[model samples]
Target: MPEEFGPVGRGEAIQALSREVLIRRSLDISPSGFITIISIIQGVALGLLAQNTFPKPTVLGGIQSVTLLLVFVSVFYYYLTMSVLLRWAPSFLDCFLPFVIASLEIPPAFFLGNAVAWNAWLAGFWFLTMGGLMITTKWSPVSHFGNVRKAHRLLHDLLRELRYTAGIGGFMVAFCALCAHLIPWQRQGWGIVGAGTVLAMVAMIVARTELRASQIHALYGVNRPPFN
Candidate 1:
């Protein structure tokens, strides 16, 4: 199995470790990090502005404001969920899910701005999309302590978590759509709260799964661990 990636000696391992350090350092100062900082600042400013402007909003303003806040929160929540829950660099296909999810929010914001109820119905599709992405992704598991069985089991658990995530999304879709249809038209704000709660609960579940999954990467040794 070691030979599969070619024999890794002490020198090669040290070089790998150095390269990993360099990469981490680069990411710390990366343009993406800078952009993320700027985005946080911008978001804070936008929140303050929205708070002042939407205090005494009209019916349309109220709907639009809540929708705007929901979309903003959805974007941050999903990104945080991906980071905290996955804790690994996903494949490109999996990485693309966030962008697709973000783009999907735009339609609800534009076309369904008339009511929170209508927005809740469309919001379900976002979770449905997440479910589909999890179902479709092919995960590559990390070998734990060079144990093939451990690695395989980790992979299985990951798949299981993906399925769990998908199921959560599916449930949320039904839940959101149901809220949209069942709730009285005048009281759709509760539907928005429900959608947010679903997202939060799903995040908690994924976070717990990831906590268990992270055991695969746990290291115990005298020397520093090698770069994976």
Candidate 2:
């Protein structure tokens, strides 16, 4: 019988090692690294501002404040996520997911301002939770893109696992937001926020999947670049 081999089996181990060494030697500090560092600093500053600006110290209020923090985190996450994609997976269209996810928060912000009567604390809590989830979700591409053929299959598989796990985690966060809005105990305006959150998540998933699938197809010669 023919030998059944994995991705690593396709090439000699020594050759792969040599190539990795050469690639590392040739690589410079990625521009994205600088951007990521700056964004993180900015995010931390924003978080501090939110903490100082909002008063009221209750669990619900905390949730609201958290949600507000999430807004800035989401933007920072998007910046980092895009930077990673542009640096490593330049050919993939996955970089767009962060922007889409970030945009979804705008409507919720407006709704929260206009409709919800919650204290600043609760608003902050919601923002922090939601923003954290969105930003973390955007980081999924780090794993998925790392799965490129050059790395060992083990590395690729690990990245794939991380990507899926993050995706599910993000989905759960959004689902929780949705439920919070829908529950009778919560405010009515939150329902709009919840609905928008769910829809945006769905859209993000679809877009990412489509882009990934297209890349896979290209690899197999079933499709071409430029997507269709």
The prediction achieving the highest TM-score against the true structure is 1
Q: Candidate 2 deviates by what RMSD? A: 15.6
C-alpha-based local distance difference test score of model 1: 0.48
- TM-score of candidate 1 on Cα atoms, chains taken together: 0.46
lDDT (CA) for every model shown?
Answer: 0.48, 0.44
Q: Which digits, one per residue and each the tens of the lDDT, describe model 1 over residues 1-228? A: 464666667656544457778766554444344336435643663555365445565554454455455545544543443343233333454445544554444444343333444445344644655555454334433432254566446545655665565456556645655665576674456455544554564465456444544554443223322221
Give stretches of model 2 more than 4 Å off: 1-26, 29-34, 37-53, 63-151, 186-228
Which lDDT tens digits does candidate 2 get at residues 9-68?
A: 444664444766755533434435445454555555454545544553544444444554
Task: Give Cα distance to truth, residue 202, candidate 1, Å.
Answer: 3.5
Clashing pairs in 1: none
Best by lDDT: 1
Q: How much RMSD separates candidate 1 from the native structure?
A: 10.9
Each candidate: RMSD:
10.9, 15.6
